[model samples]
Target: MTADEPTILATSAGYERGKYGIFDMRPGPIHHFAAELANAGEDAKFCFLHQAVGDPENWIGATYAAFAKTNYRASHLQLFPMPNHEDIRTHLLDQDVIWVNGGSVANLCAIWRVHGLDEILYEAWQAGVVLGGVSAGSICWHVGGSTDSYGPELRAFTDGLGWLPYSNGVHYDGEEQRRPMMHKLIGDGTLPDGYATDDGAGLVYRGTRMVEAVADREGPLAYELRRAADGSVTETPLPTRVLKYQ
Candidate 1:
């Protein structure tokens, strides 16, 4: 990835009511986010990857509705369990912005590997495509992160695509178990010292380094968790710029 490559915007939360919900009309920072992503790409070919949903059409319509509000056009491809599908690679490579939807992080990673999408996405990023997402979408870009993909109990997921060399934890304020688990994991050396974001907040990484923290809400924050020499965990709050709705 070049220094001038667009940063990956990973959000902890946004408008995700799924099908039957309005995408472009939903409140908050999504429309602005989508428009910015579309503008950066120069081409508005927005592609959605919803492998975590396990259903091809489950969230595609809603995703399309959301992107339609911007200058871009949207499309979704179902890759889980469909290896023989034609045009899969073409669609992925052609996307100016690839938005990954949230779901089971483990399951999404597993399927992406099976279809070799992990490598494809990395190459796409290297080619200047803007990659962004929420929750599991956010987690997939890190080296690891805390997740509840296996069961109700949250655990460390260390098999991310590794585009970013740190662990990640989403929904920092929305979920009760997330904060404590992220702290314990980094403190115990089970996971690398990494970043965490509150709902509606986003961490922006230019290449592999985090450059800024942003939010849709006024008070929501993002943080960096590090382990001290004495094995205690420290949370450093990052400066955040709250985005205005367009």
Candidate 2:
């Protein structure tokens, strides 16, 4: 795979439940996404890195159950804390997809750095692995993002893997404080102008260029926020193609 062939699928929020109750996982669309990454049913290995969860094992079972419904048959859904069964570099290189789990972005970054998974992940990405995840998982790929990782208050998080040139904002509609905080950061030059996605929507990128915005639900939009010359942030809605779950 070439440098320009790298695929990235990132979502603001997934089909998981909070206090509101359970949301359908929409396995069809997710399977389709996995199939695309797997290159039309060819065998692919999926690695689920849950360092963000703090305790990686906490969500491993749920993650496995979630992806088991997907078309990608070969998956390595394990926690970061598990004893390495193989060399980390070799393990990452063998994966066709690297799915990150959401939790604390700050903590995740720090952990990955300490374990050298950051560099390993970058290598995998460069070698054409599809890097993806939700929430903090999505946020870590870009230069920065608006996050509540530190505490209850959402703030600008400017340290990311920088695989993508710009920043990002997730849960655009799901979280009330997210929109305003992202806008303020971009407008005030605290955060770089970048992309934002509502829950259920995702932005697909081929390398650093955005190829498309996709959603599993109706009315969920993705936006490109840019700081204009006048120091105001302008939000341009990117057309999103709704993925059929059937």
Candidate 3:
């Protein structure tokens, strides 16, 4: 009921696999993300709103369809193509879960703020509705914003939705070259603690409580971050890397 309440599911940004080559109709990381939504509950509905570079319509159907197969009465917030004009904040009052897909983080944040969806989701989380996104979805949750994925010149404009206290750079370990960039970004002293997740990996924030940080692939990656007090950064190996090299 209040905006200050905790979020239901705080997630990292990245891609997840789908079933049946249907891309949308099958379950993957997302299904495993939230066990609360596992059982049939009050006719729960999950919305996959898209606003990045690609056509919203192309992804809307598959993601919505994939989520719907959860054996719950899953349905899109709006059946029409993405970038829907529907009042998502208001809709959250009625739904159980919301999944904003990945794409352009800038575009997604712009649209989210334009329609005040951020405020709505914050309110919904207090009411116990699960809130999550894939790529941009997870990035928007960070406090420093998702900087690595974007171009260098765009760093000034890379401010995220400020949902979480720390910033994140996804898919870091996937590309070895990203290490230098991450080190540079976090070392610049602009970003606080930076978290890097491999392709099949994720960090879950449950209303500010980190329940788990998991990696589906070999192991997780590593994290490079600076503490706020002394501004000293610590680079910790993620689950995957910790198991591999350590």
> How high is the lDDT of residue 68 in model 2?
62
Worst 10 residues of 1 by lDDT: 22-31
1 against 2, candidate with superior lDDT: 1
Q: For each candidate, give its TM-score against the true structure.
A: 0.88, 0.88, 0.74
Runs of candidate 2 exceeding 4 Å displacement: 1-4, 16-28, 40-43, 69-71, 74-82
Residue-by-residue lDDT tens digits, candidate 2, 21-89: 322233336435644764645345677777787654436655566556555544453435563545778
Judging by TM-score against the true structure, name the best candidate.
Answer: 1
Point out the higher-scoring one by lDDT: 1 or 3: 1
lDDT of 1 by residue, 140-235 (tens): 999888998888989999999888999898999999999999999998898898999999899888888898899987888999999998889999
Candidate 2 minimal-lDDT segment of 10 residues: 19-28
- Over 77-187, each residue of candidate 3 has an lDDT whose tens digit, in order, gives 432245344665566666656766666677667766766777876777767666766556667777644443366433522477676667676656555655555556566
Clashing pairs in 1: none
Residue 59, candidate 2: alpha-carbon lDDT = 60
Q: lDDT per prediction? A: 0.78, 0.76, 0.55
* Root-mean-square deviation of every model: 3.0, 3.0, 5.4
